[model samples]
Target: MSARQRNAAFQAFSWLPHDLRNDNAAVFAVRIKDLGAGVQTCLQLIETSELEREHIRFDGPPAEGDAADVPLLSVTDTSILLRLAITIAGVISEQAEQFCQASEDRLVKARSAATSTGVDHE
Candidate 1:
């Protein structure tokens, strides 16, 4: 995802609740990143949608009074959300780079095999 898309996703997930973040906080346990509960909640929502679905549904529009358990994504500071967006975007960029590298390697290997086999290389 580009930075634009990443920011949009971060903005979208700002409604994530507290428990969800705490549940998935272990993902970053090996690493040390001091993220707020609200930001962590949003990250969890993005990383673990299956568990998040059980806690918060997005299949359809929420009903009245159904938002009782929901916590604000960044109630105190939009800056938090922005910072998290940058972090999330960095992760996405790394993944995309890896994927692209794999794709290029596959392409090179395929071409090499085709040439060695004397097949009609395209």
Candidate 2:
């Protein structure tokens, strides 16, 4: 992803609840270098909350009556989270592609070396 796109992804994190922020005290705590880790953290939080029968809570669009503690996602929040997830997935896919290409390059080089050394190339 382009730097600008990555930056926008990080900014979308602001839509998340303060409790869900990577670091509640820091503004924009989610960094480009920690994209995968940030996404992982968010996913874990969601999974854990779901398992406990709790929806991720937010401040606004107050829930009706006794549902405030486990408020469901507002339409805006759902859209924002979905978009953020897609952006994160794109970045992760790019990183995986790069890793696979690098691995292939290394294997080709190793095979070349083995052939030259007459070491029974795999």
TM-score of each: 0.38, 0.45
- Each prediction's RMSD over C-alphas, in Å, is 16.9, 12.5
- Residues 76-100, model 2: lDDT tens digits: 5555665776789788778667766
Which candidate number would show the highest lDDT if scored against the true structure? Answer: 2
The sequence of per-residue lDDT tens digits that candidate 1 reaches over residues 55-113 is: 56645546787765443443334445556767866775665566568679988999999
Q: What's the lDDT of the predicted structure labeled candidate 1?
A: 0.55
**Candidate 1 weakest ten by summed lDDT:** 25-34
The number of clashing residue pairs in model 1 is: 0
User: What C-alpha lDDT do the candidate models reach, one value each?
Assistant: 0.55, 0.59
Would you give me the overall lDDT of model 2? 0.59
Clashing pairs in 1: none
Model 2 pairs whose backbones collide: none
Off by over 4 Å in 1: 1-76
